[model samples]
Target chain A: MATKASRAAARMMIAPSVILLLAWMIVPLSLTIYFSFLRYNLITPTGNPFVGWENYYWFVTDPSFQAAMLNTLMLVGGVLLITVAGGIMFALLLDRPMFGQGIIRIMVIAPFFVMPTVSALVWKNMFMNPVNGMFGQIATSLGFQPIDFMGQIPLLSIILIVSWMWLPFATLILFTAMQSLDQEQLEAAEMDGAGSFSRFVFIVLPHLARAITVVILIQTIFHLSIFAEILVTTNGGPGTASTNLTYLIYVSSLLQFDVGLGSAGGVIAIILANIVAIFLMRMIGKNLDA
Target chain B: MARAVSNRTRALNTAVAGTLGFLMFFPILWIFILSFKTEEDAIRAPLEVLFGSGWTLDSFFTVQERSDYFKHFANSVIISLGSTFVGLLIAIPAAWAMAFVPARHTKNVLMWMLSTKMLPPVGVLVPIYLIFRDYGLLDTRIGLVIVLTLMNLPIIIWMLYTYFKEIPGEILEAARMDGASLREEILHVLTPMAIPGMASTVLLNIILAWNEAFWTLNLTAANAAPLTAFIASYSSPEGLFYAKLSAASIMAIAPILIMGWFSQRQLVRGLTFGAVK
Candidate 1:
């Protein structure tokens, strides 16, 4: 048991981290909230007079806003769909007794370690280039015209790249969780004449429910602000085809120098992230006690 | 695992899973191969590039020569390691305090810290950019170190707390009963035990900060750019130089890739905040 003196010392020890994180969250965030209310433009910095929700009005009503909102949802949802489903399949496959299990796992998990910028650039140029990309060579050899992947299907192309990066993460988590499955129970069910499909549906899937939820919520949080892939591959272009909320705000604030509008978009992004954060926090918090 | 598995079934599993794994790893493997070829050979049809191209180290040399690659490499090293060490310094005492002397509000404090991590970086981009501009911290490695340190502190604390929780408290109690001071107990008895957890935490944090793209991209231009920013410059027309781009990418990712393989187990535990484990 901690004595009174030790408790005091504990408080002292914990102060720096608590204070720094508090300020880290509070200072810039409050400034963002403050700037969102003003008509601040870096180009015309004569005055940043407070404009009551005008930035929000313009931001939300902008046609690109609708597209960006949809794109963000699609990117996050598509990645989640692919990663979760692919992760489950990979986890199941890897769970089976296979040859070179260690090497197979290392190969499967390698993509997640590649920096986002490297992965994006490599995929864009090496694999996706219409004329010279590997896919192009394959298509041309097969007598089909090569499709410019980033140009023709920017969002889908972005999704494919992002899914490659994340599939490893989802698989690694699900696979780890799968290792904890009750093998005797599975064997018993098999002996009771349950088919493999029924065994998976009744037993394995239920066990992985928590890990799957963790994967989705965590991936959603990261996916909502995917910046590097879009910047490198698409630059949110082909007429804003792949522009998501994060890139939209990036363009407005940094590129266009519309601090007010960008800050407003930033606020909206924060709100959207908070909705997911609530669920994630609840899940992880429950685990803290366990 | 104890039960008998047929050779046919094992072979089939190998075939299916190996194919999938190769597909998953194809991009990296392809790039690795491309990095060793001439630019002319790299863009040729896949079969020719694989079978016909003469291997060369020219691209790697050109990539290093044309760009100041090592400058960015050094920046990546400093920023990731600097931030991790700084974060660990701040987090160790806090995590220890919370783990060993948790009070009524410890859980809420932890949950609040995690909630801060959930705050999207974009939400505060404007102010942070402006502040960095005014303070002349923009494009500075120290600025990134500070930002990333704050960004990763919560996870560091949470991870250390989880690891510390696993070390039985009764040992400390026994030491205290033996007339050991609290400092002595921690330094003599606890520090050695905590090293492995701390090392893994350091490893995972380094991997994260090394690959961190958002702030590294936005905050830095040339002076403090890391490999993420450096490699991003290839997004220009130069990206068409397949051999050179592949070479650059391979160099950038290779170190982290090796570290990642070693940390795969810790990666799951670290990212999930011990939720699944």
Candidate 2:
């Protein structure tokens, strides 16, 4: 609430953004919620019967639902692990005042900036080609037949490529956290005769606790919707070997043209995303309090 | 004493950092070299391909002929910049209200906005696609812009709000006390103080909006397709065009890749701001 002058000011200030965000949030979302309750399909007219929760029931009962769920969890879990672990190590290296640090950072960060479609394509062809990819070439040079990254280990290949793309982001965020660590605290710990591991565990990790949480939550939300890599590299294929929830929806709705089932799957994905969001919000809430 | 310790540790650090650098950089460097090589050389041994063969631009030519690079580029520029501009226009005022006024629900509201981001787009893809069709937004730049802006709005607002919070409330209050119009306060004072933060936020959001693929691919068929869609087309029905695809990938990613390269410090600074502090 504002005084007459201030209220007008506040309203005026906020009106444009409020309207835009309102439109942004309201239109598509309400349509989604509406569609979730109906038997709608792109191939059919919009006048289809309102099948209350049948779409949801159909979606929940599908065989692919469990696989997609598991795949989503696995990809998020796997990518997060690789990124957080690699991020920590790389951040440690980057935080140090070493030779050519600037140039090295530019190189390390290039992948994160590369268009995902392009990077996925690059990995699909130049690196993971299996016939003439760099990986295949390396394998043949070592006197072994090239293993098809997409065919032999489809999900793992996607996971590795996605992880490679995000690891730099993790490192960048964590490295900033590491740099902001209090030198005085470190010296005090050292004065108390703490070893390197002790200092890292007690001092550095504690200092990084917030950043770590931020990294986990932010990366979790984004990685759960991993689409471009699957589309580019595997097409959710080698027989649904790489289909996560997102790809499943795409296949169901676009490829298979089943909007009812796809909408249901989409609702499930939102619920799963909300679970993560709730956990993140609690962390943010707790942080705000402290 | 710490200087001497830093010096002593520097050598070991350099060795570790060097290896990490090389491993991290190898793929990008390899792709860079491949972008210039003929299809034949691109498939050769890494050692010889790196040193043995003279580079050619045939792949680039093939890419140019196949994909209209400029149309895709224009689409990317329009979508990314449009989203950022639209996002900021809305965010600035909303952030101003919360930052200046003591609203009880401001935190909850902010959290709610961000939570929308966590909702997987796939979950709502069907509905959104339907809505776009019903509204005649499909295969239109406006549809891409609105979706991208919405998709990115939560983070944009969060980033802008965080920056806005840093400006001392006393200043905004003083502007109120001075009878400076809210417009004056925002345009004349608040914006200037926060432009650096806002500029970084704008650049970072452009990058996020630029790299977005799911919505662009899903919502767009042909008319509104961006660089991501451009690259996606190269993975064909008969087989993947490995060499030409790389060149197309190179062409598609080069603009934003270069943008990111130039604006690394700013992007990282904005992304890592609150967590670091």
Candidate 3:
């Protein structure tokens, strides 16, 4: 029953958002792409000569680029492994017939609400600091030397902090999915002499496969650009020990004043994120039809 | 039918889940406790910090007095609320149109909006920063409000679209049949029906905006700094002041935490773009 007038109204209603989003996406993005090919430095104020591939070459060839790329992959990979594994265990536990389920859930989900800066600094100073941190205190009391967490193993430390924040998200999603599981199937498997482990393996896992993928893909999108946690805690310190690609770009562009180099890095980041986005969009798109 | 579990099994599950939950929540719990202690007492070992300290609100007062905590808190309130408000205003019409009068390319449009979210912020950081610098929007609440509103517009539209889709078309049709104007139909029927969904969207967006650290930290320096940036400034020698840092962190996160608890279900739906449910 959509007449021409209604269709015109509908288009009018959608026009503003469409136009604004179009501008938001295209303007800055084209600027980034254009600047990537020019030797533009804010501090030097030199002539903007077209330097095709030079910025990309330097950004890639930089020693820190390799470290940042490796660190970025490790951070994302490590946090995913921990969150997914820990989330499954938590989801299974929470899904059981247990007392105080609501309270336990509230407690578990609290960390996800804590801002990144707060969580990072809390972990850095209160738990991981060598001198006055809780870990140090426990170690000294137990007759052991306190290990320097941020100093010795910075990336791993960040992974732990980030994992703590994200574990709740994974658990909540998995738990919601688990709750929708078909009880009859589990009972059928049980009646067929399947043990609890086998029931979880055969029946419940398949049910949870989609949810797990959702968690991994969604978390990867956020984790790949973990900027605040690293900024607040490590500052990518100890000589590029914990710098991710995002942080590397921030360093080059904002800190080091190399707009062209940073824009090139930004372009690389967009490409990397787009790769992940393609898979994620496919998954979400499949779900849309379902 | 739900199976009856043994009492022993139920108790075992309770114990296990409670212990694990507490373990997962210990850092927040620890900070909450430390926030009430004196600075020196807060730095003591865990056991002593827990038992040996006298409880006081001294650090809370000190944090306010020293850093003007209320200024940052106000910035967070204004920025988060402002962004969410602007986003909802822009998004409601777009979502409403897409939901009710969807054309062939509606799905593509929705997906395109989502793809914008996946574009790493770092990708556009340079141009946006320079734009802000040149336009004198740096470190201004208006600048942050504009940026965050745009940043969150896609999610807002997706969320509102999903919610609006759940609404039956017949209600709007019936309203139309009754000779209600389009504006009256939306303001009276569609809006009331969509309030719950919109509330959830607002809550989730506020939580996201409040905890947003990267842009808030990078774009603002002092005047318009939100609590996220405020807390980050403590990441120095002064951060060694455990009680004060805890107090500041608690104040910064407490509002969002309470709001977050209410929005967990909506959060899953929104963040996953209705993919899970």
Best by lDDT: 1
lDDT of 2 at B3: 38
DockQ of candidate 3, scored on C-alphas against the true complex (2 decimals):
0.81
The sequence of per-residue lDDT tens digits that candidate 3 reaches over residues A1-290 is 56677778989988888888899999999999999999999989879899999999999999999999999999999999999999999999899998888999999989999999999999999999988999988998999999899999999999999999999999999999998998998898899999999998988889999999999999998998899999989999889999999999999999999999999999999999999899899988877631
lDDT of 3 by residue, B1-277 (tens): 9988998988899999999899988999899999999988998888777777699999999999998999999999999999999999999999999898888888898899888999999999999999999999999999999999999999999999999999999999999999998899899999999999999999999999999988899899999999999999878754448999999999999999999999999999988988887
Shares of reference contacts reproduced by the candidates, in order, are: 0.89, 0.67, 0.81
Which ranges in model 3 have alpha carbons more than 4 Å from their true place? none
Error at B151, model 3, angstroms = 0.7
lDDT tens string, model 1, A204-270? 9999999999999999999998999999999998999999999999999999999999999999999
Best by DockQ: 1
| Cα lDDT tens digits for candidate 2, B1-277 | 2434466577788778887778877777777778888777777888988899997888887776766667878898999999899888878777777667635666777667766676788877877787788899998899999888877777777777777887887887788788887678779989899997787788889888889989999888777899888788766634446567667667676777777877776665455435444
Q: Estimate each model's TM-score.
A: 0.99, 0.93, 0.99
Better of 1 and 2 by lDDT: 1
Model 3 chain B, poorest ten-residue lDDT window?
B233-242
Candidate 2: residue A24 Cα off by (Å) = 3.3
Which parts of model 1 have CA positions greater than 4 angstroms off? none
lDDT ranking from best candidate downward: 1, 3, 2
Clashing residue pairs for model 2:
A17-B90, A266-B123
Q: What is the C-alpha lDDT of each candidate?
A: 0.94, 0.79, 0.93
Give the Å shift of residue A175 in candidate 2: 0.9
Quality of candidate 1's docking, in CAPRI categories?
high
